[model samples]
Target: MKSEDIQIRDPFVLPIPEEGKYYLFGSTDRNIWGPGTGFDAYVSADLAEWAGPFPVFRPPADFFADTNFWAPEVYARGGRYYMFATFRRKDNDLLGTAVLAADQPLGPFLPHSGGPVTPESWSSLDGSLFEDEAGEPWMAFCHEWQQIGDGEVCAVRLGADLREATGEPVTLFRASEAPWATPYVSPRYPDTANYVTDGPYLFRGDSGALYMLWASFIDNTYALGVARSASGGIAGPWHHQPEALYRNDGGHGMVFRAFDGRLLLTIHAPNRTPDERPLFLEIEERDGRIALAGRTSE
Candidate 1:
């Protein structure tokens, strides 16, 4: 199948340089709000052509979460692959991120954590793994604006095994802190408006600068913004760029280096339910910040 034909959201690409393959995962269930199904991944040798709806993760019958299995990001660490994804239980309204394990990138991933690692009281999602220079693992996730009037991007230290939170979450920044982020008015609560913070992916530039790619609303449309950490760490005194990195109604993005050493940004475009498809754009670092080069021909 072609990438443009795949229906997905929160698009994350895991490029396996050794295998020369890319694995794509995201919020893929047909009815995202209903009982959750498992996650499916597509493999590609080139960014254009893809294969498989390979079932990388399927919850066991006794799994705690039955809906909102979202934003599964696979990372290779300590000789094993770990997945950081979000889930919500029917017994409770709170949604949080969890850690899963698999022997391979394209997995039969199984739950490795005790349960959702984010605070049970907080509504959080889109957890991405970040390992510090000291080799400590951390999770950077969004504290959803649905619960808080201004959504926040926060970080918590993860245990060595990648299964539990080792420290209290530190608020890195709020959606309102970003000059480019705009308020999104809730349809259900017309009088209430909130700033949104979605998908937080961390990147360490070749220049040794720390950067974060997070999604929010600009002009009431889904957009991706860039933030820089002056301290070169997760606990950042982050500064937001004046404008969005990508603002074409596509977001929930993650960046990966292609096999040929090209920096690529993967995101789901159109920002609409059921019609969203993965879109790839070639990106380059310019003046210590990310700039869109052009869409990848492949």
Candidate 2:
């Protein structure tokens, strides 16, 4: 499929320098809000025309989740590829992030972390992997505002094997804290002015600063923003930028360095189904934060 033809959300790109290819993964279900089939991926050598709807993960018969499969991100560790994704339970309808495994960057990934590493009681999603300066693995995810009035981005230390959580999740920040975040007006919950926090991704700036990219609403449009870790670590007194980085109808973004070493930010635009397509924008790490430089042709 051509890069623009794929209908996907929460777009994530994993570049393999050795393979001379980039693997694209994300929420691949036809209608992600309902029942889900599984996740698919596409590969590109030049990020232009691509080749796949590769089945990277199809759940086994007895898999715990059967709906709302979303945002699958792959990371290389210990000579293996691990996929962190979010799923909703069939039994209780609870949402959480779970770990999956595969041998190659693309594979028929199988469940690895038993189930979710997030707390079973909390509604969470969009788990992305981050290795701390000391090499401690952590999953930064969102605690859904459906459970709490203010949605939050939280981080939990993961076990060395990346199979489970080793400690309680620490709340990094709430959606309302972002100056540009607007209250989500949902008809389902009429009386509440709840805010949303989605897709928490952590990365180190060129100046050795810790930065987090997350999404929320600004004037009811899905927008992505940046927050710098004041302490230069995950356990931070994080400070939000004065405004959003990209306020267009696009969000749930993650950053990857391209084959030529240009920094690219990937996110699905329009924030709507079927029409949503992966949008890649050029970004650069300034003194301690990221700024949009331009849009990528591919």
lDDT of 2: 0.91
Candidate 1: C-alpha RMSD to true structure equals: 2.1
lDDT of 2 by residue, 1-298 (tens): 7878999999899998989999999999989999889999999998878898898899999999989999999998999999999999776788999999989888879999989999999999999999988999999999999999899999999999999999999999999999989999887898899999999999876788899999999877889999999998998999998778888889999999998988888999989888899988889876566889843111
lDDT, candidate 1, 214-291, per-residue tens:
999987889998899989988889998888998889888888988888888899888888889999888877787777
- Deviation in angstroms for 220 in model 1? 1.6
Off by over 4 Å in 2: 294-298
Overall local distance difference test of candidate 1: 0.89
- Inter-residue clash pairs, candidate 2: none
Q: Report how far residue 218 has shifted in candidate 2, in Å.
A: 0.8
TM-score of 1: 0.97
Off by over 4 Å in 1: 294-298
Question: Using Cα atoms with residue i matched to residue i, what is each candidate's TM-score against the true structure?
Answer: 0.97, 0.97
lDDT at 182, model 2? 92
Error of 1 at 33 (Å): 2.7
lDDT of 1 at 58: 93
Lowest lDDT sum, 10 consecutive residues, model 2, at 289-298
